[model samples]
Target: MNDELSLPATELVRRTLAHAKRLLPAALFHHSVRTYLYGRLLGEQRGLRPGRDYDDELLFLGCVLHDCGLSAEGDGDQRFELDGADLAVRFLEGEGVASDRAQVVWDAIALHMDREIAERKRPEIALVALGAGFDLGGGPERLPPGYTDRVHRVLPRLHAAAVLHDSIVRQALENPRKAPPFTMQGELVRQATGGSWPTWEHLARSAGWNDYEGYRP
Candidate 1:
């Protein structure tokens, strides 16, 4: 096993996992661990050295806690990404993490769902996005032989995406403000509301559909 995979988790990391286990569903808890494993795997492939190019503990915190916002306790009035980021920042600060390092974790959680942007942010940001995408079926890449089996053996995939989607839609239904424009939550709200809300795509395509260039009505 690689050092990142085999090394023991720190107190903060263990605490975060324990807290997630209590607050999040079983599938999500496992998914969180899988996310961290995937991130660590990608980091190793890229030759990133722990405590040098990156902090393993910090990366673990970012990946494992990335989806905390989806839980009822972590769900705030903002987008789940932002809420999760806030939760991570608060927890890290409470654990005496430095401001700069805590910010790195915050950025990783906040931008994991945003494609291209997250990849361009930094190594930690890119790793979290890469890990999450790989887990969620983003594309086919050849991992180390037996990597998938080993990881899945420890952390089973429990159809996490579908369950998470349902929870997000439910949260958005309860509070329209939670679904901002052009966001994942916004799309979910639109879907849940029978397409009543016009998405940015719909609006853009229909902007001048029935209007003359100089006409104002």
Candidate 2:
């Protein structure tokens, strides 16, 4: 317990998870915990010290609540990311957390889906995205030895990626406005509904794709 990064059992964390579990599908709740575990591993690999380069509490809050926008309470006119960020921020504020710390969590959750921007931000923000990206893309071979096993043992794989992807597609299908053109959500909807082939997936697997004409790295 001393060496490992354990999820705090504070009342706040407990209540937050309770609320998330109530709204999010079982697959999503497991996804959130896995995201936090990945973030913890990333923090260690980067030599981040507790209470300095990163705050474990904020990291947990950001990673666990990152996908909360998909929850019913998180739905709004804006994208799920923004809606979730706003919800997390308000929740933190209600708990009397300082505005600055609350803002870091907001940034992490809101930018988790945007790797390019999130990477250039604070460690808290970058780790959130890195964690989610790693988990969604499947466990990387280079992750710390036994780290993946440790996380998986505590939070077993629930095939959340497929569940989440379907949820996003369903949301977009229900409200075309939910998925704007060219965005990830829009692309998912397009592919799911057979509007177009999955060229994006093809390009992702292409060899030396950056060298292709009109391709930007």
Candidate 3:
């Protein structure tokens, strides 16, 4: 734990964990923690260093709080991503985080769902998206040797996909405004409610990477 993850042990970290654990569901809570772990791996793989390139604590905060909108406390009228971003920003501000840093985390949460822009941003922002996506989509083989088992051994994924999907779908069902077309929640609701919508994957392939089907990093 000390060498592999080296998770920050600040008071802020403690408060952040407590806040998230109280609000987020079991699956999401686990997924949030794993997001930090995966984000760390992604950062290392991309030659980014903690403290110098980005604050590890901020990265941890962003990853853990990224899905806050799914929680009842963070619920708001905007897209879950934006609502979650606002929730996190408020929390960070209350905890005395610098304004600029809070904005970065806001961007991290706001863009976590974006497959297009997040990867091109700074490490703190990019890692949250890349790591979250990697956790939810990519297989263990995509990571370095033994990394997946190590991460899972610490925090097992508890039906994350179904739990997360159901949570988002349920919210969108209750509040149609929460699911605007083209957003992740909206598309998910479309698929869940049996409505017609072009999937992101279909669009991505049409946009060109179709020839790189089996390509691996």
Candidate 4:
């Protein structure tokens, strides 16, 4: 709830929820949110802090909107990530965020799922890595020789990323800024379940949500 980070956070949530409604399966909206939440937690546990060299505002905004494009055309694929990044860039630009800052968010979204981006070790790339728990792949020990030295300079920003992730997820769920789109499948699920939503664990077991196994945070 840092006021400094609130503006971008709000915009990111607003856009993401809207996108989710339009593009995600009604049954998958909750799961998608949970995946985001888990990603935040994983980032935190791995020592990814927020608000340091880079703006925590940018990091928070980017992380929340990172997966929004998944619903742009209604599927989970790399294209979704690309679309989401484009959407975020456009939104931030419209908001008059400095072009540089907007680019940071853009880069973060583009690289969140691409590890090679991390290996390149740019500060922006590192911020995205920390925000998405990308470093959790091979553990700290597996990092290239100079990885620690490079990231050390940006540790505080990393921490800010982690904190922003936690804050955004809490706000989104506790008081969802927007709801999933109304669709036949979503409506049917809602009606059949009496408005009850399944937990991530339940969805994982019943709907084959195993891609994230051992990576949940």
Best by TM-score: 3
List lDDT for all candidates, in order: 0.80, 0.81, 0.87, 0.49
Those runs of model 2 whose alpha carbons end farther than 4 Å from true positions after fitting are 1-5, 139-141, 196-217
The per-prediction tally of clashing pairs is: 0, 0, 0, 13
Error (Å) of candidate 2 at residue 210 is: 33
| lDDT (Cα, tens digit) per residue for candidate 3, span 142-200 | 57778888878777888998999998999889998999878778889998898876666
lDDT of 2: 0.81
Against the true structure, whose lDDT is highest? Answer: 3
lDDT of candidate 2 over 126-152, digit per residue (tens): 889988888888644377678777777
Tell me which residue pairs clash in candidate 3: none
Model 1 regions lying over 4 Å from their true place: 1-4, 199-217
Model 1 local distance difference test score? 0.80
TM-score of each: 0.85, 0.82, 0.86, 0.42
**lDDT by residue for model 1 over 1-217, one digit each (tens)?**
4553563457887787787788688787877778778877777778876777877787778888888898887889888878989988888799888999999999999999885898787777878888888888746666888878888777778888887788788878887777876688888777767676665556766886744546576
Query: Residue 175 CA error for candidate 3 (Å)?
Result: 0.1
